[model samples]
Structures are given as structure tokens and as C-alpha cells.
Target: MVKVTFIEHDGKEHEIEAQEGLTLMEVAVKNGVPGIDADCGGACACATCHVYVDEGFKEATGEASPMEESMLDFASERQDNSRLSCQISVSKKLEGMKVKIPEFQG
Candidate 1:
């Protein structure tokens, strides 16, 4: 399992352990992480699962694909580090991954 930390708008941190091969969005929604509302599952279509990845976990998680990039354009609070959580595949390298949920992700 891998550890995922989600930072909420009110400065709260929610941590959960996810099985390998599960996407970040899967972990969030399955565990009711609140901020990540993955409307399109892992299709990379809806941007509701948006999150800002911390710089420490960026290289391990890697950049979003062009498909994800295109979808991000529709996110509510697009930012320099904005990413669709569904695009992130869980791996040992991402054990301590931390992501910040935008205040207005609906």
C-alpha cells in the first residue's frame, strides 16, 4: 500500500493508504476524501479530481499526459501544479505523496 495525504482548503490533512495500481482518484473517492470528486473515473475527462501536488512528490508521480492536460483546462481552480488525481497511478515511489485540494474544486 502507498500513503496519500490530501490537504484541504481549511488546512486539514487527510491521510489514507491505497492499494498498488489504484489511481489517486480511486483512493480519494473510495475513502470519501471529500475534495476529489472524480466524475469521469480514470478516463481523464472530468477535472473534478483536481489536486496540487507538492514539489517533493512531483518527479515520482511525473507530469500529466496531454489528455490530462487538456482536461485540466476545465478545472475550477487551475494552478501551476494542478493535476487530475485520476491520472496518478500508485507506486512505491509515491509512498509519501502529498496533494493539496483547491478551495473551489466543484
Candidate 2:
């Protein structure tokens, strides 16, 4: 399991032991982490699963693809570190990664 943390808008933290081969959105949704709507179900078609990747883990998360970047345009409060959780696969490289959920979905 890859260890990851999801920080809620109000600063609540959920530490998760996520299975590899699953998307970060899957981990959050399965763990019932609030604020992750994931309406597109990992299809990269919506911005509801948006999250801010922690700066320290940026390289591990990698850059968003063009499709994802276009989708993120719809995300509310998008930032430099913004990414769609569904687009981020859980892996050993992402162990100990942290992501912040915005106050609102797209």
C-alpha cells in the first residue's frame, strides 16, 4: 500500500493506505474523504476530483496531460499545483504524498 494524505479545505487530514494500480481518486472515494466529488469517475472528463498536489511531491505526481489540463480549466480555485486526483495513479513513487481538496468542486 502506498501511504498518502488528503487534506480537506478546513484542514482536516485523512491518512490513507492506498493500493497500487488505483487512482488517487479511487483511494479518496473508497476511504470516504470529503470534498472529492469524482463525478467523472476517473475518466478525466470533469474537474470534480481536483486536488492541489503538495510541492514536495510534484515530480512524483508528474505533469498533467493536455486533456487533464483542459479539464482543470473548469476547476474552481485551480492553482499552480492543481491536478485531478483521478489522473494520478497510486504508486511507490507517490508514497507519503499529500493533496489538498478545494472548498468547492467545478
Best by lDDT: 2
- Model-by-model lDDT, in order? 0.87, 0.96
Q: Please name the candidate that would achieve the greatest TM-score relative to the true structure.
A: 2
After superposition, the stretches of candidate 1 with alpha carbons farther than 4 Å from their true spots are: none
lDDT of 1 at 18: 87
Model 2, runs deviating above 4 Å = none
Report the error of model 1 at residue 71, Å. 0.6
For candidate 1, what is the TM-score? 0.93
Candidate 1 displacement at residue 49 in angstroms: 0.3
Task: Give the range of the ten consecutive residues with the poorest summed lDDT in model 2.
Answer: 54-63
